[model samples]
Target: MVNKPQKTKLSSVISLSHSESTRIFEKKSDLEVWSAFDKGDEMAFNYIYRGFTPIMFSFGIQITNNVDLVKDCIQNIFIDLRRKRGALSEVISIKSYLLKILQRELFRSIKKESIHSIQNIELPESAFLIEVSHETKVIQLESETEINTQLKMALNQLTARQRQAIVLLYEEGMSYREIAEVLEFNEVKSARKLVYRAIESLKQILKN
Candidate 1:
């Protein structure tokens, strides 16, 4: 008689399929992942939410120091994305697009909670904080403390918009067009000019 073949369990097969799908989604490019999400792929949505939630939280906290507000805004944007995924347009950079949404949401929440009659909600220079990393300190070595102090002081002298522009350009590695979209600038040149002026100001401050 021929030997009988062993059959795989349905549960094991399903688990393996899910694991493989997750791995594939993780490796996909942003555009591909986004397109998958737009098509109502649950795995693609999970990949996007897991990948970007931390980044969105960090960016939101910089806009305003309120932790709860940032958390709520992040949650709300993800929910909105899920609800409107089919209607969403294709974006060149997913990071920049999500960030722009979070920034606007945070600002709107802040304005609603403010008691003062404010025409425009301009964030105080103190509101956007940039902390130096421990790795950067180790790299600087001998003059770390003094240099960190001076660098922070230099940053403090910049306007809120300038500081934000510098961070988006250097830390986030976004293009001028992306930065313009995030900051609501009319043109890409405006974003370019903002970064240029910010760098020049930093150099001048460091020189002194």
Candidate 2:
């Protein structure tokens, strides 16, 4: 039998030319892009996904130490964008709008975790093995321990719902609208009030 060379697939090697790449960004204003996206413009949505995913990823990492959780939060936010597309409207800025969505999603995830966190067992001692000088170590340990103690005191100062709202909005970066949706509050104002009251309580707690 004669030997024959195997053909490799070339389809995957296709790439965007420089002009094509430039055209994508130069094509539309933010409002126009999102308005089209609202009506099911897949291209617009794809552009939005590409532009905002990294920002969301950064915010997620800052709030949650778990990379997997960050990935899951971002994926869920994009899924939400698709799911809510029909109701989207012209906004002041696409970047801000996308960030708000990401913020809301991350907060929702954090609130859920906080609710379930009590069930978590203590981590092994090996998790705290980083080294420093004895004085620095003592200061670091005392700082973290004091923060936890103060946080608990602050939590006790607020009503349960207020505490949850504060944690989700301030700690987790969720917006008032998202907090309303998650908590079944009547409006964003209500969510804002919940957080506001909680902050006041926390200030009082810290002062004492």
Candidate 3:
């Protein structure tokens, strides 16, 4: 039951425009759906949860190892949202909006438990822990068990903020502006720097 990142970008300089175009359309549609859901559309609300719960779950786990707590926080947020329906503001990106809300809620829960976050970043938790899929093609050369262990160890070494940056930028495919909104960074430049530094740090650590 290893759930990891999915639908990674296929390298193709030729189709870059088409890919970006498709992405933009999808983002626009998601925003529209969210707007409808905000206005008391039950079907639209369910649609959002069905599509994003898994991704949100993955993101939540990076913040804390308590799977049950993460699940509760997710459901709780939606329950609160449902209660506050029709008052919700227009959102540019549903994923970013949801992540921002979820992050705030998760941080509150983590604080009650008195957990220490990595690098003392704002609202930080311990090293962002992750579970890699054994099926990842890049690690196919190594035995599954060995590769999985290595991947987890490497991820565990990263600060919480770095891991959050990696998950948002890569796994969720968020733009820097969207990431800044979700992570509450002061500027988009800070989000970009965080992602770049995280990648460089991962490359160095994983090469060992």
Winner by TM-score: 1
Model 3, residue 61: C-alpha shift (Å):
2.0
Against the true structure, what is each candidate's TM-score? 0.82, 0.45, 0.69
Q: Estimate the TM-score for candidate 3.
A: 0.69
How much is 141 displaced in model 2, in angstroms?
A: 33
Look at candidate 3 and give me any clashing residue pairs.
117-125, 118-125
Which rank order by TM-score, best down to worst? 1, 3, 2
Candidate with better TM-score, 1 vs 3: 1
Give the distance in Å from residue 102's predicted Cα in candidate 3 to where it truly belongs: 1.0
Tell me the deviation in Å of residue 176 in model 2: 18
Tell me how far the alpha carbon of residue 115 in candidate 2 is from the true structure, in angstroms, after superposition. 4.8
User: In candidate 1, where is summed lDDT lowest over 10 consecutive residues?
Assistant: 1-10
Top model number, lDDT: 1
The local distance difference test score of model 2 is 0.57
| Model 3: how far residue 186 lies from native, Å | 2.6
lDDT of 2 by residue, 53-158 (tens): 7766765454456788777767665665666778866664665465556556656666677756544332222221222232342123445656756655556556
CA lDDT of 58 in candidate 2?
Answer: 60
Candidate 2 Cα misplacement greater than 4 A, ranges:
1-22, 25-27, 115-208
- Please identify which of the two predictions, 1 or 2, would achieve the higher TM-score against the true structure: 1
